[model samples]
Target: MTGQEENGATRKGPTRALVLHPDLKSERRRRAPELALAEAVSLAAALADLAVTGAEVVRLARPQPGMLFGAGKIEELKARIEADEVELVLIDGPVTPVQQRNLEREWKVKLLDRTGLILEIFADRAHTREGVLQVELAALSYQRTRLVRAWTHLERQRGGLGFVGGPGETQIEADRRAIDEEVVKIRRQLAKVVRTRELHRAARRKVPFPIVALVGYTNAGKSTLFNRMTGAEVLAKDMLFATLDPTMRGVLLPSGKKVILSDTVGFISDLPTQLVAAFRATLEEVLEADLILHVRDIAHPETEEQAADVREILESLGVEEEVPVFEVWNKIDLLTLEQRAALLVQDARTPGIHTVSALSGEGLEALLDAISTALDDRRTIETLTLGFEEGRARAWLHEQGVVKAERDGDEGHEMTVALTERQRAQLERLRQG
Candidate 1:
């Protein structure tokens, strides 16, 4: 094992990993098998310090129930793993518990399916308390059914099973019950966290800034675009799931209006149901956003499929049908001159499409102008008389830089200020209070 220092102590390097994607030629696929295999390799590499030794797409007419792959195919992969000295096999699809156990016993190697690997990545990368709790909850939900993994202490029996049993409580049953209890505790704690988060959002509502949310498929350059727009040093990497927790920063639009830009966890095709449910509270930023920026990795070969997946997840989360969303075609710098021109033409024909390279800063001015226009459309200049007794409200308007002009009136101060519908509603709420 290779030793490296992290945080203060030495840590062992990750296990050597082999990745495989099952390519069923008889079945239809939205994305090419080669691209899917490459993505699988990337996902394997993304897991903390993992070294991907080899990766390939295995052609299959159909999967075997006993072992995902046939005996001949298993021997072929076993030979490859031995040749490469691979300790871990990461399958880019679901594996039933029996199939997983059989494969592990046959190859004498650890196996992880897509969902299990994702949970591992999330557990390693989560930073915030809520993020940590959510990942744990999702992981427990996943493990409740798969307690037969050899590493689990299933051989250790519990005391006394009143029901018909050869021995006492089996390890699997005990583990399942323990996981269920832990899930209940986590849900209770998470509910309290959610309530506190709602309180924070309610407090932010009084500040009168429109929330603009950034969302996209994994590694589509959303965080890079967020850094460019907000001038904040958010983690921006080519790796998938690099940004796990949500990040928000205030930015000034071209029209001199300040707005909050929120960067959220990237979406992936076939995202685990448990993760989607657990991260729903984190994704509420999208549901509550005044505008959503649907960033796209335009240069990717599977860009259309990825975009479809992103839209599917958004709809699954019950994003409002009427919420405004803008398509941001990113990574224009990776395209050839001819491809760039073709994209520009297509973007021109599209109603809400904006083409840009977040790295090179191309077409950002027009994008910023579009954002300004979208937000400005909601703002209105209105004349209002704030009584001297309402000095606090007058001060708030001034602090928000919404007061364009003001004058002393007979009873109070008369002012004309630009305000959004949300801002006006907040003002009314403040007065009512």
Candidate 2:
């Protein structure tokens, strides 16, 4: 029922939230604090039915170990929380166990740091089996560190444990042993899923189409662009982590080459090291991709930082440096006429950069052509001779549609074929095996 009220507006009762971002005043910050605070509010809203009642950027010259915010700010915010009847307070940075507990006690409300809020969003969005397992595992890892607080007598505190309950429970299902057991169980199940996925990947290797992966920070229009290109109805919402499961669609590029386009889970800054460790199966899609498209919301103020976060996650996943990647500047339709021209000039000056608005289908032709070129760049024509006994190689060539001409010569069948370096390797492996 959307948790709506009688006036047809969002109900701000228990779901009411105050988004507080502790902006560390640093010269090395990549984005403005206002932009960070706004992103925090967006993230809070992305969680399960959280209606942001208020938001603020709290400048922190230095972090407090016991309580994140000062006593004065805590008391003041407590009054606001009480006046507004806010049920949740989401801090847009890491909060130690002691800090979270103290703040929660002071505010008389639940609290979640950046990682906890993201984990909640992930858990809510995870639908596929592997995705569900990954989310649980990540949440368990986050929960392990947060088993207790300042009030050690309480054992496990309710705040900062990410989402609460299963199908329906009011408080976070937590504790050390519960989290440990859940983590182990999830790992076993995920291992099975990972093996199955490997078999699927092996089967995909037998197919000829190259795999192109779309990766970027959350809500950077990756799924939208994937839908625009592949005509697949993926859940392309304006919310964070809208697409949790990795989705693949067969896309025919402008060059008429069929390729598998994969839309993966979005990356975010400080994306929970546990998530990075647990979601390797989904990240492997990026590793196996013949080309990676770093989609960016060009209209966002933190576009550069978002792109950097995606790159960092990719690197952490051990994505090879040799993989050809294209910087796809998405949402150009949101730009002004002058801004679009500037973007075009910037894109033209870069070798692997393209600008496109996935929503409007603008500059898509050029983007498609770029995809074709990047995939085709690894191709080379070569002549190979296969005996009648080597019908498998001959059939594989025909399957790949890379054979330009084939004729039965005296000694054997000689044919000229065009294929990528990876394709050449695949052919060699087939011949050797």
Say which candidate scores most in lDDT: 1
Write down the TM-score for model 1. Answer: 0.82
Q: How many residue pairs clash in all the candidates, one count each? A: 0, 0
Q: Give the TM-score of candidate 2.
A: 0.83
Where model 1 places Cα greater than 4 Å from the true spot, the runs are 1-12, 150-170, 379-433
The C-alpha TM-scores of every prediction are 0.82, 0.83
Put down candidate 2 lDDT per residue, 342-398, tens digits, no spaces. 989999998999999999999899999888987877878888888888889888788
Q: Which lDDT value does model 1 have at 403?
A: 83
How much is 205 displaced in model 1, in angstroms? Answer: 1.0
